[model samples]
Every structure is written in structure tokens, then in C-alpha cells.
Target chain A: MTELATTLEALAVHKQFCEDVLNMPGGEKIKICQQCGTCTGSCPTSYLMDWGPREIIAAFRAGMIDRVVKSNTIWLCTSCYSCTVRCPAGIKITDLMYELKRLAIKYDLAPKDGKAPAMTKYFIDSVHKHGRNHEVELMAKFMLTKDWGLPFKFAGTGLKLFTAGRLPLFAKNIRGRDELDKISAYLEAQEAKAQ
Target chain B: MRYLYYPGCSAEATGKAYDISTRALMGKLGVELVELDDWNCCGATSYFSVRELDSFAIAARNLAIAEKQGDEDLCVICNACYTTLAKTNRYMAESAEVREAVSGALGAVDRTYSGNKPVRHIMDVLVNDIGLEALGEKVTRRLTGLKVACYYGCQYSRPMGDFDDPEFPVTMDKFFQALGAEVITDFAGKAKCCGGMMMLTKEEGALRMCHELLKGAHDAGADVIVCACPLCEMNVEGYQPRVNKTFGTNFDMPVMYFTQLAGLAFGADPKQLAIDKQIVSCDRVVAAIPA
Candidate 1:
């Protein structure tokens, strides 16, 4: 590949990042981040993140879309909204994290080590099938496919909850479960038209 | 007063006690709750992480039903559902693109949402609409000596602090006080995150967060911790042993849904309130409440 073509391709990713963030609700506020660390400070799990909220903003400004998408920071977010409420710039940091997560999944850039994406996929699948999330089914699928040791670790609590009748064995399918599929189909067509 | 209730998916399973107690408590308060017919999942945080438009559409489906089914405001028990549905409303009102996409999706499903329905938290309805004075009068057995750490968790008032302070909510505290329970107003972890779904995806981070919340309630000398969200209740109560195992600390705390405790105060039977469903026995806290 020629150097100029490679440069333009890199620039396209940066441009796409900006456009994606700008399209989100309250996404424009990302440009006003003061390089302040309040978001990271307020983040309960920032210590475990590969890139804290503050650093993510800085990276966004630096046009390092590749780096941001490849990091574990977005997946680690618990959607607590602490950073969004605490940011002095009025930036919706949590929303920004969600956008990044979507981008990572779209480009197939999500780290293999991140279990959040898998959990999210299984969760959505459950919703698609039953119109509501079946807790026992979702947990069982995730534990079996993702973490084999979870059943053993959760056995005591699981048995107790089961005895209490809190853990039901069957999922209740809503009457209008097909309505969800229709909604998805419509949205997919809209996206295709946009593209 | 009547309202449409959206019991998020958890209420059917892990949070059934919350559903039972809420119904009993509201019934005693003379507030009629009509469950929203054919409600689906709000997609929670999981949906938005992958597809934003789909999340808004699914969440708005319930709102659309609420608009079609009744004139009453929608009352939501789960914080995540409240936030997701409220968020769809906010985004629809703010962004023309979101409005267009969501309306198109809803139209395909033969439903429509005008974005005018109010999505409310139960605590908000109890404290604001029902009035604390009225709630106080309904209490037959006052929780005179109970020390309650009201854990708001995240999403209770965040990103849209319409009803309470996003950072430090006092609605639960004030609600408990009205029932004559001793409210721990200074609990540091009252509005902190309890790991939510991360408890399954990332155990270490979630366990650490739960540890802090449990420790805060313990330090406040709380006899019981009352939660506003099911995920918070599960993480703090269901995983207390896991938290202790990870943190190497001995902590035994009874975490109940705020409605469960409120039901007891409203003179509802313990069985009716589903108090037996709690993992950590609330028998101590129950005995402490004056008969």
C-alpha cells in the first residue's frame, strides 16, 4: 500500500470516531473535556481500566481511535454514571463509553479477554427469545460458555435462592415477543438505507 | 391514586420479593398499581452497549404501551429500567435523529410514543406524590428502632436527576424516616455502584465495589440495609459471602428492598411481604421493629 493511501485510511478511522461520538446524545461535550481527572477519580473501577475516562478523552483528541477501541477501559465501565454526573465539562462520559463499546463490537476489535461483550451478547439473545431476560438461563449460558467455575462458586447461593423459589426454572415469554423482532428488522433496514 | 407499573425482568425471578412487597405496600397505601401489559426488557445497560437505537426502541415499547393503556404515569421499580426508559424520552426530546429512528422502529411494531409519558421511580412516587405525611399515617407498626442504610445505588438519579440528587440522594432516607426508622444519612456508599451486571462479567471489580458498600453500612451501625434496585440488593446480599471471601473480612448484613421494610411498617404480614425470601435472615431486624 502507498504511504498516502495508508495515511488517508488512518484519517478515515479518526473521522469516523468523531462522527460516531458527535452523533450520540450529549456527545459534542467530549470536545470540551478539560483534561481533568475528576472522571477517573470518581470512577470506582478506573484502577482496573486500561485507559481511564480522562485518558480516553485525551486519546480521542489525539486521534488515536485504534488505541481507544483496543483498550479494556470501555468494557470495564459498570454504567454507574458517576463520571457523567461529576464531570465539570458536562460531558456524558458514560455515554461516550457506551459508544466506544459499540464501536469495538462493530469492528470486531473487542479484546478476547473482555467477558462483558460475551455477557452482553447472551443477555440480548435472551431478550430476543423471550421478550424479557430470563435470569437463570442467562446466567447458566454465560457460566457454561464463558466461565466454567462459576457454577461451583455460585452453588451455595444458587441452592439457597432456588429453595426460596427465587430462581425459577422456566422463562415467561411475553405475548408480543415477535414485536421485538419486527422492531429490530425495521431498525436494520433503516441502517442499511443510511449506509 | 393509580399508576402503571413496569416491573423490570428481574422482578419475575431474583427480585420477586420486591414485587410482592411493593404490591402489598402500595395496596396498603391505597395506591393502585396496574401492571403494564406485555412489557418486555428495557435492555438495561447491556443493550445500549451494542446497539443504541434498538435499546431506545425496546425501552420505548413499554412507554408506548403505557401511553396506549392508561393516562397514569409509569412507575418503575428497577433503577436500570427507569434510567433506560427515561433516557429514551430524553434522547427523543433532544435529538431529532433518535426521535426519527425510534419512532420508525415503533411504527414498524404498530405502536407510537409521543415522548410525554413520565417514567417515575417508586421512591419518588412515595415521597413526592403520595406525601410522607400520608405514608406516616399508614404505618401501623412503626420501625421505631431500626437503623437503615438506604442504598440508592447508581442510576437512581444519575444522568437525569429529575427527582433526587444524582450524587447523594436523600429520598430513601427521608422515606424511611417518615416510617419512624432511624435513617443513616451519612452512609458514604449510599449512591455508589454495586457492580450491577459486572458481578458476572468481572467478578473482582464487582466484589470490591460490594465490599465498600457493605463496609459503609456496617460502619454506620445499620441494623439493615435497604436497597432501591434489585441488582444492588442481589450483589450486596447475594454476594456477601463472596465479598467476605475475597476481602477476608467477616461481615453479616441483612439487605432488604426498601419496599420490603416499608411493607412491614405498613402492618403487612411478614409472609405477605415475602420476607422469608431474603437470603440473609431479616429475622433480627424484624424482631427489632416494635409490634
Candidate 2:
């Protein structure tokens, strides 16, 4: 094992990660979670999750960021906001999930061959290239880079959609490319400063 | 009613039917929707998960354009766009740090966001600006027997609950009723999630959620599922085959945008509404609706 993994396994929890989570937008509210499991109960995909919503919050409070981050729970969050609305303590569980996803990307913790992270990266890449998201290009890149089997898997649906004229041949580009470029650079600089 | 239309990326391609129906409905309702000039993506869920500021900035660019255009009210058709635009607008107006940083970013592009502009979804405009009574007056074909499960899905209600009950919203149900359709009240999955972005990344899990939604509507005896969001429609309608394959249950529930249903009720041409473009055939819905 690497030195970082050895240290992570030795510690009860990572204090710095706990503090980081606490610092996020909906992070502070997580302290108020009572482990009622309302969020998990309301979640539709929690069954497939490695760590349930309630358990993730408990892990966050316990300072076990490694357990929460290394798991596939963050990637599986659909951002439904059902957990947020149903929380008696008013914990923004969904927002915290988004924050966890952001942190997951920062640490490069997503599993190898994980399509979720790759899909997200491809989506951002599309926006960076074109001012708007191009679904065809995004799908093509995702299939090419992450999952080569996807194109074959979706062939039936693709043919049906293409025949129906639902799939466009090219993505529509927005005007004022320079403005988006400037805005992206400014935000990148700001984020670097925050880090 | 005049508004700036921000048709997100989905409306142009995958959700083109939604675009057609929205335009048809807006035209029939006598509402003017001037397409927002040079509007870009809202960064969807992906951008925000990668970098928060960039996603906010991208959405803010669209808001800044509307702000410059005399700050006309922005109407978004996609639920993701509505949520992202509204969330960014609120953050820009409420947070000094965000406002200053975003303003500095916009200044780099020679644009500004004073946070005076308003962003709303089509449902809000339909329910508030154009009352249901006025809509009822224009209905030429009342869908008296059609049973529709008004599915709001996610984002439309939650993380922001100004327009309707986030949990058990009746705005769509009531609107469908105004169009003379029997709205299904016992739909268990009315406010459930359709696994939005996961439809691409996690197909099996997304299919699981879609199956439940379809089964709920089917169990409730709904002839069709009516929704306002493009992602919800695509996930529920486009993936019905996979959902059935995953669950081993046969479900042929047709999903249509609420605007399409409204367009049909207002006696708009079916072709103009793009009713035939649906992945899951709306033939059942057509067969049921009187000519």
C-alpha cells in the first residue's frame, strides 16, 4: 500500500477532511442530522449505494471522510433533493452529496472504469469546448474514452432515435465564444485562490 | 405575456419534442416567448460537481444577457436549467462573496449581473401569469376520459419551493384537470426522482428508478405520464424498454410533456405539437383523445 493509504488506514478519521466537509455550503447542517434515516428511506437509489445517505452523514460526523469518499455513494446520488426536503433537521443532504462529488473529483478517488466520473468530465469538457453542451459529442467521447462497449449497447436505441430524427448530426454552437472564455478563466483563477 | 425563452441544450436535440410542444402551447396561449439571444448551457449537474464557480459563471452569463435586455423574466423549459438558473440567480443576489466574484468575472466579459432579474419555470408562468380559468376557456378538445399522472420529478420542486409543494405538488395535476383530463391523485411516484443525470452514467440504477415510476403510474391506472421537464420525460419515456428488461415487467405507459397535453387540449395541430416524435409511441394517447 502507498504511504497515504497506510496512514489513512491507521487513523480513526481524517480531521482535515471533516473540517473540509464542514466548510462546504450545506456542510454545517450535517452536524444536525440525527441519523433518522429519513433521507435513505426517501432515496430511490439508496439500495444500490455502497453507503446509504444516513450512514454517509454519520461517517462525515465521525470524521471518516475516507470511507465516505472512497465509496460509490457520492457517484450514485441522483440529486433528487428528496432527502433534503424530508430531513427533520433540515440537513441539505443532497447538496452535501454534490460537495462530496466535487471532493471526489479533486482527490481522483473515483474507481477505475467508473462511467459516472468519466461522464461528468466529458460533460464539462463539452461545455469548455463549446459554450453549450453537445449531447452527441459528449456521448461519443464518453463511449470512446471510458466505455467502448456503450456504443454497441445503445445501438438499438440509437438507431431508433436516429431514424426518428431525434439525434442531431451536429451540435449547435452558441455565439460570443470570447465572453464564455473570459468568464471561465476568471472563475478558474478565483477557484485557485480559494484552494 | 412576454418573456425571454432559455431553451437549454436538451430542447434542441434529445428533447426536441418538448421544444415543439412548448412553442405550440405558448403560441396557442397567446404568450410571447422571445428566444434569449446567445444563451448558453446552464452547465447541468456535471459542471457544478466538477467546479462550482465555473458552473455558476456559465449560468450567470445567460442571466447577465437577460439582465442586460431590460431584465425581462426568463422562462426555462428544462427542469435542470430552471434549477441551475434560479439557484445561481439566488446565490448571486443573496451572497456578497458570490455576487462580487461573479460580478468581477462578468466584468471581464464586459457584462454585469445586478441581480435584479427574475428566472422562472414554465409551470410558474402558467399557474401565476395565465390563470387556469383563462386556459380552460381556450380548450377546444377537453380530454374528459384520459387519465394522466402529473409527474413533476425532481428539481422542479425541491432545493427551492416557492412555486408549489415540493413533496406533493398539485400544480400540474390541477392544470391537467383544467384541460379536462382526469388527474391521477394516487400516483406514488409523482414527486419521485427519475435518476436524472444517472440515466447516462449509471444505466441499471437509473432503469430501476424509471421502472418504479412507470409501474406507479401504471398501477394507478394512468393512461399516460405527463411531465414538464425534459430529462424526466427522456428518462421515463426513452428508457421504458430497458426498464422493462431490467425489472422483467411489461410496462408500456406513454410519457408526454404537459405542454403537449395542453397543446392538444387547446386544439393545436398534433404535428405542430410534435406528438409523433415521442420515442415511446403516444399512439395510445392519440387513440384516446377525440378527433
Chain B TM-score of all predictions, in order? 0.99, 0.97
Off by over 4 Å in 2: A1-16
Question: Taking the tens digit of each residue's C-alpha lDDT, what string does model 2 give over B19-71?
Answer: 88999999998999999988888988887787676777788899889977754
The TM-score values for the models, in the order shown, are 0.97, 0.94
B67-182 in candidate 1: lDDT tens per residue?
99999999999999999999999999988989999999999988999999999999999999989998888789999989999999999999789999999889999999999999
Residue pairs in collision within model 1: none
Predicted model with the maximum DockQ: 1
Worst lDDT 10-window in candidate 2 chain B: B89-98
Residue-level lDDT of model 2, residues A1-195, one tens digit each, is: 112335654342345456667875556787777888999998888999888999998887776667888778888988888888889998878778877888777666666678888888888777767778888888888878877787776777787777767788787777776677788788778868976
Best model number under TM-score: 1
How displaced is residue B21 in candidate 2, in Å?
Answer: 1.2
